[model samples]
Target chain A: MNRSAFPPLNLRWLMPLLLALPLLVQAADPLPSWNDGPSKKAIESFVSAVTSEGSKDFVQPAERIAVFDNDGTLWSEQPMYFQVLFAFAEVKRLAPQHPEWKEQQPFKAVLEGDQKTLAASGMDGIIKIVGATHTGLSNEAFIDNAEAWLAKAVHPKSQKPFTEMVYQPMLELLAYLRANGFKTYIVSGGDVTFMRAFAEEVYGIPPEQVIGTTFVTQFQNQDGKLSILRTPKLAHNDDGPGKPESIDSIIGRRPIFAFGNSDGDLQMLQWTAAGSGKRFTGLVHHTDAKREWAYDRESKVGKLDKALDQAKAEGWTVVDMAAEWRQVFPFATATSGQ
Target chain B: MNRSAFPPLNLRWLMPLLLALPLLVQAADPLPSWNDGPSKKAIESFVSAVTSEGSKDFVQPAERIAVFDNDGTLWSEQPMYFQVLFAFAEVKRLAPQHPEWKEQQPFKAVLEGDQKTLAASGMDGIIKIVGATHTGLSNEAFIDNAEAWLAKAVHPKSQKPFTEMVYQPMLELLAYLRANGFKTYIVSGGDVTFMRAFAEEVYGIPPEQVIGTTFVTQFQNQDGKLSILRTPKLAHNDDGPGKPESIDSIIGRRPIFAFGNSDGDLQMLQWTAAGSGKRFTGLVHHTDAKREWAYDRESKVGKLDKALDQAKAEGWTVVDMAAEWRQVFPFATATSGQ
Candidate 1:
């Protein structure tokens, strides 16, 4: 009689609870900042499929390489690219040294806050400005100047430090992937050294993992001390087609995951998707006008035109920022604009 | 209570044993392949000092960067560089495709097995041979070819695979540094792509961590598939001054430790030593003619003149292969000749 009474106490209840315990703990949401949607689902599923042991889609930890475009994908890239803004500010800072800059077309446009003329100056004009402002300094000095500027530099719209404006969802994604054994790398169009100045602090990506446009540097032995001097000459233009080329040359392995925000990342995504095995590609579409600056085909900085089309055709996840993200910037308060 | 009665259990006997436990376990010879000598002492002491918490010489894990030259420093480069041998073999492999190579100066020299003529051709001639054989293939194809050749190719004298010819002491050193949280990188003059094919397997260094001379690669999209095609154009010559330049551009941080066996690594050593903290510089002096081929100033491959002199003047550790290393090649048996 006692056995019958105790047996009815139902071990069934504990069975389901025990079964759900592993799922609850093992599947803690890696990307909490991400709103529950297809983009987040795509990322989570891909990571799970690749990381699960004995699964056909399982990729070894060493082969789980992920590449991300730095500017709009990882952080805000408007009113213009942050590095370009730095160049403009540098133009103003160095204008006293060269009074001619006050009259120079691009430099004058930069000094006068003329966005239209600056855009009209084209890549050649931009290169000249970058050369004039970004070169001839030792790497240490350049890094110091960049770091100091970054420390104080605020976004034009957000009025928050640029580093603080990095997308919280993306940061979560980066950490999520890294925790899943993915080696995250920044394959950006920005200056490699400039990105290195803030990458580790802001993104938790070390300098060695930040691959970007490189300026020619010369090793100088001056008075028994050695220094690497940055030169104006562009060593590798890691943009568009250059992205895949640089990744192949530098990383040597084709990445299984790639994230980008513009046409400059088109080839990279293509290259990643073309790899033999499961691959994941994501495009951060800036559709959040109120929370963050929204621009696509018509916008100059971080233009998302061709890559947007390619993402649709290739079944790549297109992250509609306004909808997919519960929060935009890491520093955003309830009342603060994204 | 029974202090005198039990003779205090000889408590003092346990003191030295307990104190030595940590020293015995934690300080087990990390570099057993290295003999008990100044070179080993220098390496052990440098590692201990930098890794010791609260020590003035303590380097943060992130800052514990070490760069190693691949050719003579990690592996044997005598009887001509193994990569050069590979190039020569490639020239022969592709002779059918280029009938003109039969008559071309450098190509003809390589195809004809004319070492004297190839040597007489100087750097220019060698470049021609490398350009002819090491280019035109897609990166994947080139790496496949390189890996296939490495799989089958044996050293002319030792009959050992080139990878097996790597020094055991250096391998131990690499593992030791890695165990101490040091990031190891290969900053070599060898082709960056070539070294990458076997770097991970041979040295436990990843492709992204291998910095070397780069050949220009063009992104090719063929039938909706993306491939990076290696070109004959030399992009960056990562040797001598270029070593420091490439290290700065690629690694972004100055290495605290640098190891090399040639003048080509002079700037790298200088740059490492010139860093603002305690640094280690090691020169692998090829002094074991009987055990391994020895040629320094007079050798075309792995020249070790200027750097050797500089190492002595700068107090950099000079590792004599014969004396400092208990074993040279990793596969060496006790009775095996160098």
Candidate 2:
């Protein structure tokens, strides 16, 4: 039977042929926003090598753990970190509750809109602001306040909701890794509970997979009902060296892949690199002043100095946001689902 | 065109038919060791109600979280908690290295095997013992010691490895819940790291899903390599009210089902019960003295006083181990993985 003897098939045959044709074709690019560069190529190569069965780098599905640093890596952390801004707003919100806050240095600076004095106050001022707003409420109440704020809070420059400011390329990378049997986790310097509110919806990461700084919480039994109350004291810092420490304590596994932006994530990248296996480490270089903020070593928040230097020396992929990504935030496309 | 004529077919049809027939049959009973009682009935009914789509109690798969206490619930905790035993053994193991331990109060009691004096020392003494054995080493070192001890250590009464002391009915229940879309987590008063070593192999729950008491750890850079050294300091004590606090902090979602045995678990049960929609709470009564050690109100360890009262008053399923379980430990069955 010569195949050339047959003409084009009927509508029924054409329908089934059309339906099955795509399966035989090459799949669509998972990270479309990512420019065709060495950074994207490295990610693709790493994922393929690890996931292909019978290969030397084949990792079991359970062991395919990937951790990401939240602030500068997944979303923008510029002109000051978003959480610091939230803290300042919180100081204003709670100003009426404590009359003495009007006279307080950090509180007064925040209330007076004096960024210079607040910056001079340093981490001590930030901690005080965070503790004042984040603690002294039931866990549910704190979560409610955070959720309400996130619903309305917008980026100062972008004029987009804070959630919408997440990197589209990174979002695509998360989905791609997950599709290849990786469990993505957010190991952040931000509050664990605060990150949890939007992590699931924004990054497709569940709450249990998010590890971050924590405040001391007290269990309360009021009128025979149990509730957890967030306290003023800090529990775990989850920054710098605390990143790897929290990873070991909570995750109980060395992640094969780690992505970060700043020096705070340097230890996490080092830990991942130290693991005896096929590992991938990436640093997001915020070099996009036109599309996004671009302060590095001199920046107060998310300073990416040591990590950027180390990434080059260690052969870790350094994602130049301006050059490597076609788009920065997800709000560029209507179908991005920010 | 007659379907009846095609039934009297070839061996090819018969072979595929034989293979597919088992798929149509009803599934085997997942909880075969559980006796027919109100406790068993309640569990089955609750799981079925919540899992059935379009039902009033239907729950999403992501929300089907179940938490369980370790000691006295999953395994035996009589004669003293297994961890306390491990601490005592560790004290003896490290006695030669620290000759000063001979003169210390808790250390001397632990080294001398003086149960009476150790009991008098209370939680303070236990904490000291735990700190000495569990901390000061790297995370890997601590896990290795715990794993080594668990491998050789036998229950005094049962003369079996402590891992073999897990309740068979509860194991079946875990499998049942998981089969019905529930994710089981061990939220225990025991050490989190200690549980992770065996939880995956024995209980089928992964380390990431386990939440328990934590010890302070410091990040160390030894010869340019990073390591997290467990400190000789107590961190969060996940007991009684701390159970709920840890759950809120770590899991970040209220469990729909909670299983526990003692007063340490009361708050966890209360927290689970307090959640809206379908919820289940279970308590193992420790009523089987013949098969397993039994104790309740006045017992120093595995005390089940207030929780038992609450279980009765709040319609929580109280599992009478003696009457409700056909077998206690999984060792009885030849097919059991243990």
Candidate 3:
């Protein structure tokens, strides 16, 4: 076969197209669930600036740390925080073991479905409930309990599994940042172990990257086997000022990007903003009562008054859930909410 | 240009050789600094079993966690723990600002270079010294101070920077483990921030992978700037049992591989060994007196007595440094030690 007989392939024309394949793919909406609004634009602009090779705002891959609050930001936190619901459920689950709980104010209220009495018991009651349900078991056992609870529990309004209630827009954003070489972390106010049960599978954030409230553990060796036993002692609160404290203690670096929706996350956003480089901080405003719950300033769970004000004052992106979210939950169909 | 003219390339014969290329390359010694001995063999076998596909002991990449004690396992801790040495040096450097250090017992002893008095003062004195030099500053300031000290501090015996004192064989082991899909972490009794300053540069372990003793930090906002201020308060004492507790709290998973050289690391090794899989626990026995200091049962710092006996009883890998290490420090040459 002579070389001249074969038609020269016009492959030169395909070179530029092939070279721009990645860019073309990226040109497609990275966050499809995010409506074309300030929230989406702010995210894309921040990510692009940080990822562009020669841009002044470009950050090294290792330093591109982005932290998001688990409750109210990544997932809905209304009808009370999910972790509190888990704790309340635990009181009822363990009520059979503790008959005295039927007489105990908090436990009795939980078992009787009396939210009024439980609310009246206050923070002390909440602490008591957490102590009974979260401690005095091995780490493995506690994780097992949390995993079991999450698998079966559903939101009262949506009737979807707790993990299924994660915001679709936030999930897409998490994936988008990760694809651009950013390490996404959940810096929440929930218990570390509790968030860890569903985080890796649902959000793709690993156990080591999930920083939150922590409890003291003990190294216990029985005969030849060893176990880490959880005790009823608070190690770190991981809320409000505690968020920044844990960030510094555990992550050892100030994150350049932060997302939250409550006053508890104000310090974290402030800390992110106070960094020396171009920083981004955003708050997810609960403004959609039709698709999701919409209580902010007056809501006991995930109150957003201070942080919402700060986001407006600082010109931080405040996501209007009603207008900025094309879809809320992943399970919501176009006919249902989109 | 012609299929038949290529003589079929004899490609069938080359297939076997091509297929075996990876194995041939892997056959090269991954841990070149380790002598052909039981410690090296044990490590190779453990890594092989856990990393080999379809093996009953094979662990998922996400679960392949390895923890190492920093003080004596990765680097030499003779004269005194390097962090303590840094504390003493800090007392001297900050003596001008801390004029009262001249009158305080521990600070005075550190300032005067009075070893006998310092030794007599015991753990209380050490804690006082650590609190004074390590806390009451912002996290960034504390880290800056630590980094500056590490930049200039040298091991008294080797006359090399403290970071240079990291063991060559241990460094090779860390790399080998990482290459085979293991996440390596440093779990030590040293202050987390102090270890973090040089760990990433010297040991290739990042700050997030380091779990150690911690001080309480408070989030402070001055005007519009935010900072994590280090409080003079003990958060967690990461030694012995504290090691396992910190590992559980921070990593949220039990490590499968652990290494240490002192009683402080015993609990960590036990915790790793207790994980339900093919696990590895190692102890670096300080048996070489010429290349490095040698002390076990009677040592004041990094005492290996209890752990040494436990390793023998439990059949954990005990590295006889003088016999097993082909080279000790990276700076050590053939003329110096080989």
Candidate 4:
């Protein structure tokens, strides 16, 4: 074969084009689950501004921190938070060990499945249940218990795994932001250990990236083995103003973008907006009674009255689930059909 | 161009080899400042075991967490911790505004440059100095004050900038671990804000990776501007057992490798060592009195007594500084002939 008969295939120029083609093909719609609306437009434009080099709003990759509220923002919080359900289940599971719980009000209510009595018991009762169930175990043991429960547990209303109840549009948004160099974080009211179990798998957020309400932990050396023991005391709540406090303490940088669903996230939104740059503050307004639960403002769980007003006044993106989302859960097709 | 007279370049076969050649050449000794010794050999072998695929001790890249103690382990902590020096400088800088500080014991001692009286003031006086200087300012202001002091602050004996006092061998080790897919973190007895000020520039560890002692801070909305206000109240003292506690709280994973120089880091080392599989724990023994301060059990600052005993008993790698390190500070040549 004469070498002169063959045309030179320039591998240097051709290889890069070949490699980049697949990426271009894969990067079709970053927010496919999102319906074309003001909510999606706002998100897209904000990301574009921050990521584009030479743009006035461009933020360095290191400074592109994006925080999210977990309970209502990322996943459904209807019928009450999923972690509370886990706590109630835990109380029932440990009932056999605690015979005294058969007499105690909240524990008895939990064991007997008396929802009315448990609801009537209020914050004190919830704290008592959390303190009992969430403490005294090694952190590894607690994580194991939470993971085991999450493995099989189903959401009562949706008849799906709790992890499956994550908002598809929001999931798309998280991916979109991350694709644009934003570091996604879960700044939630959920306990750190509990959220850490599912966050990594479900949301692609790592354990270190999840900041949440924390309980005091002690280092225990049992013989040669070591364990972190969870104490009953609450170290940080990570709700309301506590969100920004924990964000500053843990991340040591203010996020340029924040998303939330209730009054608990108001301070976080306010804090993010106060940064001197082109920032994005968004709220997930529960406005679809059909696909998902729609109660907000007057609802006991994930109340959005003050924050809703602020969102409207500040021109922040308020995601109208009914109109803005083409899909609800990851398991369901567009509109969920259920 | 006469095609019959030319030969094919075979670029396809040539490109990859050309790209890989530089990498091969650049991957020289990972720790250049580390002398050929038991300590360096132990580190190299442990890294090889964990990073090698199919090795029984191999760790996944995400799980390769390495924690380091900042004060005596990474840099010189004597004549005293650099942060304490900054605090003393802050007192002097702010003394003119506080007329009452002239009569205060610790403040008067600081202002008068009375080392004996200041040393006599002990921890309580030190706390008073820290409370006055480290808190009541916004986190930004506190960091600004710290950075300003660090920029000009020089070690008394070494007469080098405090940041330059970081151990060259340790810096090389940190970079080496990071190169092999390990995430480096500073779990130090120093305050998080204080350490974060220089961690990224000095040790290549980011702010989020620096876990340390923290004072309580409040999220303040001053009109439209937001700031995290440092409060005087002690939130968590990240020393002794607190080291492991904070590591678990922030990182949410057990470190496979840890380095320290004092009893304050003993718990962190124990925590890392207790993790299942191949682990590395190290301590820097300050035996180089001519080059650096040498003190162990009897030293008030950077005490190494208990931790030295633990390292010996646990078979942890202890770097005998005088023998193991070819260089101490990055600014100096092989021997720092100060």
Q: Pick the candidate with the highest lDDT.
A: 4
Error of 4 at B68 (Å): 0.5
Chain A TM per prediction: 0.90, 0.91, 0.93, 0.94
Give the range of the ten consecutive residues with the poorest summed lDDT in model 4 chain B: B1-10
In model 3, how large is the Cα lDDT of residue A197? 98
Candidate 1 interface RMSD to the true structure = 13.2
Residue B311 in candidate 2, Cα distance off native in Å: 0.8
**Candidates in descending TM-score order:** 4, 3, 1, 2
| TM-score of predicted chain B versus true chain B for each candidate | 0.91, 0.91, 0.93, 0.94
Taken over the whole model, the C-alpha lDDT of each candidate is 0.88, 0.88, 0.89, 0.90
Clashing pairs in 1: B291-B338
- Top model number, DockQ: 4
Descending-DockQ candidate ranking: 4, 3, 2, 1
Tell the DockQ for candidate 1: 0.35
What are the runs in model 1 whose C-alpha is more than 4 Å off? Answer: A1-28, A334-338, B1-24, B334-338
In candidate 4, what are the lDDT values of residues B1-338, reduced to their tens digit? 56455554447776557657858846889888888889999999999999989999999999999999988999999988888999999999999899999998999999999999998999999999999999999999999988998899888888889999999999999999998999999988788999989999999888888899999899987776778999999989999999999988999988999999998889999998888899999999998887776888888898888888989998999988988888888887656321
Give the C-alpha miss distance for residue A3 in model 1, angstroms: 52
- Reported per model, the fraction of native interface contacts reproduced equals 0.74, 0.58, 0.64, 0.65
Query: Candidate 2, B303: how far from true, in Å?
Result: 0.4
Which pairs, if any, clash in model 3?
A: none
lDDT of 3 by residue, B169-251 (tens): 99999999999999999988899999889899998898888888999999888887677788988999999999988888888
If ranked by lDDT, best first, what sequence of candidates would result? 4, 3, 1, 2
Candidate 3 per-residue C-alpha lDDT over A152-208 given as tens digits, one digit per residue, 9 for 90 to 100: 998898898999999999999999999999999999989999999999999999999
